[model samples]
Target: MPSPNALRRGRRLSSALALGITAIVATTPAATAGSDGRFGWPLQPRPAVLRHFDKPAQNWLPGHRGVDLAGAEGQTVLAAGDGIVVFAGTVADKPVVSIEHPGGLRTTYEPVRAEIPVGRRVGRGTRIGTLESGHPGCATACLHWGARVEGDRRRNREYLDPLGLLRLTPLRLKPVRP
Candidate 1:
């Protein structure tokens, strides 16, 4: 019911928006897998995702900063990439293991009993710890996997979805036809 000129203008705006989004996705390092495509799943057999990542607008805001993958208690948890163990100890009474990968990316796994020690180098899929059952909100045992960009200050750290380290399907764009 609108004029032809208005319709054309709307189409142009929509196209521009799509292109802008594509550009951002294309440039993001985490859009794909790691730089060497050596990243992998932390849990063997590809555990089901109990909860997805929900990043808050601000770092201090309340949000699920990581993902919860369904797994059995005592199940081996592997390293998603080649990295050195930075911390393998308790945090707030919960067992935790953190690894520092290349490119300043750090990965954390909570409710896990650390099998490796700090400063140990781990390759992709190396056993880092065993998943524990105390993670709240999960019906069964789950692994809370998290990733962040290591920064000098805590406020400068950028949290990322640990699943992004996996080499999933590539994003393919196709032309839309009228």
Candidate 2:
């Protein structure tokens, strides 16, 4: 039988572990997307091809962490916004791409072999690399992307929903003058 103090300690430790895991998962990118409030960024993944337009539920603890896109293998990966490639290499058994914008939002693309070199600034629609999400730990074959706003804690996440930033408003032609 466990003592009362021991039980209390165990509960506290479990709580801490759960919180830590939540923080990590919330911040990390996923093959599926939600909101994109992290980097003062534009709406995510350019919701043009993929048909799913469902927004994630509001957590209230933090805004959306990153954007996600379901893609085919070896599809051309494009830049989310204008920024310099800060990280483009393999980590945790998957290819990764990281970009930092002048606005202070740090964006990352995971499960991809970035074609662009680190420190090179890329504009919107610039091809960065190919999708490498089929590897182990990246089962869904999708893009996991996230962003970090300036002056925010490293672990706090506190990101904006990428969906709002990445949404594509239909373009309307101006009225023809008589």
Question: Best candidate, TM-score-wise?
Answer: 1
All candidates: TM-score = 0.76, 0.55
Candidate 1 lDDT, tens digit per residue, 12-74? Answer: 999999766754553368543475577888898988899999999998999998899999999
Query: Model 2, stretches more than 4 Å misplaced?
Result: 1-64, 135-140, 152-157, 170-178
lDDT of 2 by residue, 10-66 (tens): 999999997666555544453113234222322234433222223345434433345
lDDT of 1 at 81: 86
Number of colliding residue pairs in model 1: 0
Off by over 4 Å in 1: 1-35, 170-178
What is candidate 2's CA lDDT for residue 42?
A: 24
The per-prediction CA RMSD against the true structure, in angstroms, equals 15.1, 12.1
